[model samples]
Target: MFEKLSYLQLQQYWWFLVGTLAALFVFMTFVQGGQTLLRELGRSETQRDLLVNALGRKWELGFTSLVMFGGALFAAFPLFYSVSFGGAYFVWMAILFCFIIQAVAYEYRKKPDNFLGQRTYEIFLFINGSLGIFLVGAALATLFSGGHFVVNEMHLSRWTNPLYGLEALANPFNIAFGLMLFFLSRLLASLFFINEIDDEAIYARARKSLLRCTLMFLAAFAYVAYAIATMKGYGYDPATGAVFAKEGKYLQNLLAMPAVAGMLLAGVLGLLAGVAMTLWGGSRRGIWPAGIGVVLVVLALFLTLGYNDTAFYPSLSDPQSSLTIQNSSGSRYTLVAMSYVSLMVPFVLGYIAFVWRAMSAKRLTVEEVENDPHHY
Candidate 1:
């Protein structure tokens, strides 16, 4: 069926798949968010262990989804992957280090006589949750704000700064975007705890933290939204393939793509409604709506960037060096082969859903965790 589609169509299809993976990964980051909640919700050793075990159950899933997201993007758009991964070494390296330590923490946190104590490993999880998520958000913001990279005629890319991707930290808008995702992750983690844990004290503390996180999430979102709404965006001419900065380009994309605009609006409202249901309506299932909202919002944002002739990875060092789906995609033969493999995605998702249901069949309890021989 994909044989009939044009090269551009195949690129769009792969980008859609990549974007979906990314959106799901964002939702899966509740694991990272929950990592940050180990201390706040868990007041004692057992309590902390309960929280750790709870997050541990799903950390591998989050990590797996993240790897898949990156892999899909790399397969679909090798240029974007090479440019960002090569040029943004510092940011990506720090994120990679955070994930490595996270793996170490979960594996050895409870091991007896491990040179570093459990608390040290716990700190590792915290860094992965906070700094890691923040940097991921900042890295994503570069898609909209553009990066300081130039691509030669041979298509090799180079970073324009000594700090490499660490320079993203210098942008206030990037920082706000990072903070937004960081707090959003924490908020989602709280909602997840409210849904997953059976302890009353943990639930109360989770709710308490949720309220503050919600406020912080909204504040950071406000700043990022304002910046996006006000910022000039990169666009390319379909005929000539030259990139240019247009005033309010992102806003124009939203206006031009009404369906995406609707998704964005629905996503915002759904996210807020989920918080209301938990905080006011006494609903434990807020994670469902909130998680779905995160996927929709992120998916819509990604669509806005990759669709409508916009530059998904704009270049500030050289305007024409911007990477779009069209310019950065792999050859048609590669995309077609990948497209066939992508058909198995639905079956994989079905397996994940089955496992998720089996795992969460009952709320996690301290007693259960204490008795389980395999508890993290």
Candidate 2:
């Protein structure tokens, strides 16, 4: 069944898979967001412990999802993996360091003979939650805002900027996108706490923080929306397949693909509905819808960047060198063979669900953390 499709169809299918995995990774960032809330939402030592243990139950999922997303890109779109990871080694190294410290913090924080102390580990988690997530957002922002890399006829790429990927931080739009993602993670984390902790104190604090998180998220969302609507976007001639810049190209893409536009609108509404359900309707399952909303919104944005003959990775230094799905994807045989493997994705997702349900079968509490021998 997978062998008969044209090369473009296989490319689209694999790109869709990549986008789906990316969305899941973004949704799982709630764990990172919750890490930042350890001190802010937890008033006492016991409360902090509760937050830690609850988040600890799931942090691996987020980290693992991120790794899977990267791996998928590496396999399905090796050129992008090479160009971005190779050219932007500094930023990737920083992100890798942050996550490494996070794993260390969780493992060593509760160990009896740890010399660094718990506070140091907590700080490490905060850095991973904040700076690590921010850098990811800034890096992704280059998809829409464009990067400073150039590719030659031989398909080799180089970062024209000396700072490598760190230069993305210099772009105001990237900064705003990073901030937006950071706050969204926190917002999702708060909702997760409200639903899963079953402690009134933590619930109250988490609920209270939602207002500020919503406001901050909305402010950043507004800026990003405006920027996307107005910025000159990278595109290619569908007829000629030549990359170039065009004003309001994102808007054009959205309009050209109404289904994507619908997804974006539905995603926005789902997010708003989740917040409303928590704040006014008094629901505990806001995170479910909110998480789904994050996935859809992110997926829609990714589609807008990649589809409609648009360049998913634009090159500001050399416009024609931009990376598009047509140019950067794996070979036809590679994609067809991998498409068969992609069928296993459903079972993988089901297994993830099973493990998640098993791990979270019982709501976390101080008593549970106190008694559990393996609590983080």
User: Can you tell me which runs of candidate 1 are displaced by over 4 Å?
Assistant: none
In TM-score terms, candidate 2 sits at 0.98
Instruction: Tell me the spans in candidate 2 whose CA falls farther than 4 Å from its real position.
Output: 238-240
TM-score of every prediction relative to native = 0.99, 0.98
The Cα error of candidate 1 at residue 123, in Å, is 0.6
192-283, model 1: which lDDT tens digit per residue? 99999899999999999999999999999988888888898889997889898898888889999999999999998889999999999999
Best by lDDT: 1
Model 1, C-alpha of 256: deviation from truth (Å): 0.7
Q: RMSD for each model, in Å, please?
A: 0.8, 1.0
Q: What's the CA error at residue 351 for candidate 1, in Å?
A: 0.6
Q: Which candidate is the best by TM-score?
A: 1
